[model samples]
Target: MLKISEVCCEDEYDSMKNYEKTPVLMKRAPFWSGAAVQNAKLVNISMKDFINKYMVLIFYPYDFTIVCPSELIQFSDRFEEFQDLDSELIAVSTDSQYTHLAWTTTPRQNGGLGGMNIPILSDKNHRISKRYGVLDEELGVPHKAIFIIDNKQILRHVSTSDMAISRSVDEVLRVIKACQFVDKYGNVCPMRSPCDDDTCESKNTKDND
Candidate 1:
């Protein structure tokens, strides 16, 4: 297991404070993106460089598997909606770029990604997975994890699931919307079930009670 303590250097805050334990959202991590079957290309995308909008990096164990493709496809299906809100969705795994390319070329019925518009990053080194604290100790691979980073380069949210269970893109979108709402209005979003309709704009923040 990757310890958070090992990754921490020095944290900056609005005020100077001494702390033995590292505070979350104060450290920057780098990740590689652009590893898609459509293109066997790799580009270094650092969290430090992203200034505005949000990023959703969903990590799965590997490519060409039972659950990974569906998750990637589902996100890809809803790609433009996220883009309209100024968000980028990235699927990641500890697989080689060649494997990723092959899987994307294969058809979905044939148990491959077929083709996904969103960037499927190849974290062959597992550096981002470990840095984000989602690395599986035994297999030395990433578990099902989704990291939501704000435009300010701060990690805003994290959700993880087991290998057998697939994740919900709707839930991830809801969280991202909530984060955006709060960031914009400075009010917490109401605790409600994710709305299936396009009325996400009507969400209201809870008032003092």
Candidate 2:
């Protein structure tokens, strides 16, 4: 497990902390006013369409890379699991749509994803990544980040990993399940008995009638 401190330097850590507490109203997802990706054909994703739907926006450093393919293939193979949870997955990269299309058409046996079912959005201008604060300006590539948005379009969870490490798909599913459980139950489900925690003295208290 990569510790938070290991993932970010001190300055980055401070900036992230400030970003968390800052009271800025985020411009909602699907912020395109007029200019959208060409081809309406390029993944053809629109924010309005995804509103009121659970979404997972995953960013990779770039395409046609070794570690990236492994992760992308696994995610694509398990894409149906996400759909079963009422969530849509969209992968993003700093590469242009042209690159994405070319790669998608290439055969997986030849090291390409090959007719992937999911939409691979192009962040060629880096606008979306900058908005999400995941762009690495120095490298001109996005940090590996995953954003989980609820049906309300609120950003519920954010997880980022270093370029070399791949995130666990199981953990992603667990988070979605946890979020859904909370949404339905109005409280977080305890993984174990409350009495298991020594600090939870209230668990042992008896009601006096």
Best by TM-score: 1
- The clash number for model 1 is 0
TM-score, per-candidate, Cα-based: 0.74, 0.74
Native RMSD of candidate 1 (Å): 7.4
| Candidate 2, poorest ten consecutive residues by summed lDDT | 31-40
Candidate 2 clashing pairs, residues 3+ apart or interchain: none
lDDT of each: 0.67, 0.67
TM-score of 1: 0.74
Per-residue CA lDDT of model 1 for 169-197, tens digit only, reads 78888888888777755655657743424
